[model samples]
Target: MDVFDRMQNGYLYRPEDPNLGISNTEQLKKQRLFNQTADHTILKRMFAAFGDGSQLRPPLFSVWGGQFVEVGRDVKIGPGLTLVDDAPIIIGDRVQIGASVTISVAGHPVDPTLRRRRLAFNLAVHLDDDCVIGDQVIILPGVTIGKGAIIEAGSIVTKDIPAHVVAAGNPCRVIQQVQVEKVEPKMAKSEFEKMRDGSLYLPEDPAILAEQQIHMKLQYQYNNLEPGDPKQAAMLKKMFADCGEECYIEPPLHANWGGFHTHLGDRVYANFNLTLVDDADIYIGDDTMIGPNVNISTAGHPIWPAYRLKKYQHNQQVHIGKNCWLGANVTVLPGVTIGDNTVVGAGSVVTKDLPANVVAVGNPCRVLREINDHDRQYYYKDRRVDLDE
Candidate 1:
């Protein structure tokens, strides 16, 4: 039998076979695009079988790509998602995967001779619907995670985890059975409200963590883009929830949500090292220009040290109005707003709202002067505008 046929039958086969290598090479190309592309729907097309509304967080390392992968509806996978999909990987509906989770289906033979010859076997991994896999969890070959199961963070799942149980630890075991509460849909607290209401909630909650992972992956792809690539602008538009026309941002842009929580208006230009702490919405109006090392934050934590251990964070929106210019090394704190036609001088820290038509400077930025006729005549001090030219 051919190598592929042997692989299907779970028999020993040369992984380095020429035909297999070619097939793998092609899949790798697709996999690269799959990981880097802003569109998650492309992943569904790449896999052997995929259900509707499934999304894979990028930088998703995979062996033999998605050739043997099968996913069900609404499967949300987090960043650093590694799948050794040499064998079948069947993931069911509504599976929430946390960041840095590894799921493998391929294993090497214990025999020395087989190991020397670079031989391996694969077993299908089945994750039933409504399961949650926590961060940094490693799921080994042939493991089955039952429906509604929860695998805690930093766990290594070596065997099957039965339905409706919470599992944790290395070589993970069942910690406890999850008691099902039949609460009304209206009574259940939404994740968005839990995040925004300043309430102490689980940041590592599968749904929330999955969103974080997706953002990180998209940011990774954006950061790695070569300068002058035609796809850069298009990719950015797709990555962000709202990016207006003619907006340009230099490389090394950092955001917690990969600009997903950021809204930029038309013709906004940001220099390098523009860091956005966009936990909540950050709005920038049209024709705004931001210099290097600018940090605009919307996320803040509690003052109590003990509360910090629980990783509780609160978010507030930051707004910058139209035609503003923020100079280098400026930091805008949470809940701050800058008004239209404003200028924030270099190395300024904006902690409070600044009104329109002013030149602001320094830490805890204050208005130095409002826009006047003299300011309009000169671009800088004594630099007269060549209006005739």
Candidate 2:
């Protein structure tokens, strides 16, 4: 099948197949299930370090290597959740997740030609604890969600979410505030059991957490080393040894010395080919992701004569809130704050602050729609998942 068919069928097609453009229905279904199960296993093992009490409800799907995926204690996850982590994705205790929620924590360069040149870009995502994410929500990269935030079903989280607020809709807005009470141990156990058995529900694990951490450490080591010098390979190796649980950076490739700075929270992730340009500081909140080829950069040069002469001094700060997603090829400009739980569209140029709980797309990026119960109801009315309390 072609890329579109593969996406629609939720499976990867064989490259050598003569009829690669045709969808293999049976294979697609089987591959979808396999992918979900594999993602669930990876998530289980990765979070296994978090403690035995941590939980994950299955049917969670992801790409290779489980980049930037993190789970919290006593958490619940639902089906059809796609988390693309090239960064970090962190979760807090007692969070509830809904189905078909897309959390991507990575982005690529804005210039198409430069992107083809494998130039690094800068973007990341974060999500705090004690949040409730509704069904069919799309979270973009470089966003953060504060503690005790509630994202209404089908809402798109595009910006930062302040603590203890209820945000929803496309380009999600702060519609109201929610009163949150801690779940007692006994109650927590009961809820966990219900979710594990597929009765109660929750959102998927944020996939950016682990990936971001790995990317940050790799960039830090490379920044301190010499460029194009194989002698410096040992320095990079030693740095990885010292990283411990903070991150995992695979082998370096050509042009791996792009300066990128990333600051991560307690839990983070950075998937394959995650690039950074540390010419500026890129701060990512706890539990975020940086997906494959998900580039986070602060290396843009100014076009004006005076500023251009100075080569656009790299001192800007790109701040990403907790619990967000930066989709594939999503480009974020310098000095931008992606609000918590926000979703940015692929191939988008983010030039300003995106408020929390919204979905945005297109060049120059306009708010496409707000994720809400009405939208959720329209899309998933027939689904068995229960989003409303």
lDDT of 2 by residue, 151-182 (tens): 88778888888888889899999988766564
Tens-digit lDDT track for model 1 on 1-389?
77887775578877776777777777787888876674766676678887887766666778777878888887777656788887788888888887667898778899999999998777789999888887678999889999888888789999999988889999899989887562111112334445655454456655566667877898889889999888888978977878999998999999888998899999999999999988788999999999999999988888999988887787888999999999999999998999999999999999999999999998889999999988868988899887874
Error of 1 at 75 (Å): 2.2
Reference-based TM-score of each model? 0.64, 0.37
Q: Which candidate is the best by lDDT?
A: 1
After superposition on all C-alphas, the RMSD of every candidate to the true structure, in Å, is 7.2, 28.1
Candidate 2, residue 239: Cα displacement in angstroms equals 53
- Pairs with steric clashes in candidate 1: none
Off by over 4 Å in 1: 1-6, 9-14, 17-19, 22-25, 36-45, 181-262, 266-281, 287-317, 323-330, 339-348, 353-362, 365-389
Top candidate by TM-score: 1
